[model samples]
Target: MNADLSRLANYLNPDKKKLAAKGITSVRSRVANLTELLPGITHEQVCQAVTEAFFAHYGERVDAEVISPDKTPDLPNFAETFARQSSWEWNFGQAPAFSHLLDERFTWGGVELHFDVEKGVITRAQAFTDSLNPAPLEALAERLQGCCTARINYRKRAKRC
Candidate 1:
């Protein structure tokens, strides 16, 4: 059965509306009963079917090209390219500012830590506690400033805190 794909895309994820606003077209839809009817279908079969449908629809408008599977494409700057793409600055440094909160209860008292994060670093931190002596918590909040919140850095710094 055919479905209204644009409506289905909006129904599935409202974020696609932003894609449309940015002049990016999205082909978003799902087949519901195909797998139930043919449970033994292989990944190659699905790819072939999708490829055939795409070529048929776009017929003559698209040029087809194929590269041999055995040929290895030359990439001279592979190491540099990989390093840049996989770096934390490339991945999370562009993220918008946000706040994270963590709450814990210790034998002495309960403590809540709030972090204001920007550019993948903890810009500001605050700690609230019911403990009679809050000096340790204050020091921890101070230590968190300017610390990278990436998983590896956070784990190392958190151990010290």
Candidate 2:
């Protein structure tokens, strides 16, 4: 989560936005290597080259404008909202209610499972079996409620059964 926030901060940082404002008229790439592009491979050299490239691509000569990060305004609740919206549960847990069926045959009997799913988790479970003992099946159905349908999660939960 910290990594995600850091990435968003870096990309949306004022310094990066200032660089973007300079605008690119064109970008022509030929068969070239990084060594050729930056002989020194230093931060200062890279910044200088990139700054020059922004103006060099254009036919008309224009003075480069200096942008202040302090002057840039921040959006309200953007980071928090973005973090929430990008979460796994927010994206996948909103799935519509559905039902799932699984049938399997063991040495003792054949079992059929019916599950009511909501928001990607099991809300209810019903099990039918041809075996004499139905206690295990009832217990299994009770345990299934509130379990997620994801294969890995289901596998971990199914271990008890």
Candidate 3:
């Protein structure tokens, strides 16, 4: 009825050989479950045991920081903000020294901006609008190439379009 916690520990620890040498070989096959163990273990005791085990196995001390839940900063409400913006939807991808894409969709128009991040400039841009005349949007897209997103004046840019 008991789970194989030694195997679990071996799987969790980076150094399996050192873990096996400690008397944890089978993790007491008779204990019947983790629920029973939890009643007797404190969080700090568990942390100290793991830290001691890690130091014993690796011969290096491990430092851990404990932060209270109250000390953490509140996260922004992105979903509420996204819901309020009915006219546009946006998505972006990022990675170091590689091509990144920024796609934005307006209720009546859309724009896709591609960048060569390693070279620090826009490589391509394309726009779509419901208007029969697409030349302006297309030209705007063309003009936007080689510009950096961080420096763009969106309000001024929109006025031109």
Q: Give the per-residue lDDT digits (tens) of candidate 1, residues 43-157.
A: 7788778888998887743544543434434668755666787799999989899999989899999999999999988999999999999887888888888887875354555
In candidate 3, position 115 carries an lDDT of 52
Ranking of predictions according to TM-score? 1, 2, 3
lDDT of 2 at 160: 72
Q: Give the best candidate by TM-score.
A: 1
**For every model shown, what is its TM-score relative to the native structure?**
0.50, 0.43, 0.32
- Tell how far residue 113 is off in model 3, in angstroms: 3.9
1 or 3: which has the higher lDDT?
Answer: 1
In candidate 3, what are the lDDT values of residues 32-77, reduced to their tens digit?
5644756666666766887999889999875765434334334486
Angstrom error of the Cα, residue 153, model 3: value is 1.5
Candidate 1 lDDT for residue 126: 95
- Give the 10-residue window scoring lowest on summed lDDT in candidate 1: 64-73
The parts of candidate 3 lying over 4 Å away from their true place are 1-95, 109-111, 129-131
lDDT score for residue 155 of model 3: 67
Candidate topping lDDT:
1
Question: lDDT per prediction?
Answer: 0.75, 0.69, 0.58
Worst 10 residues of 3 by lDDT: 86-95
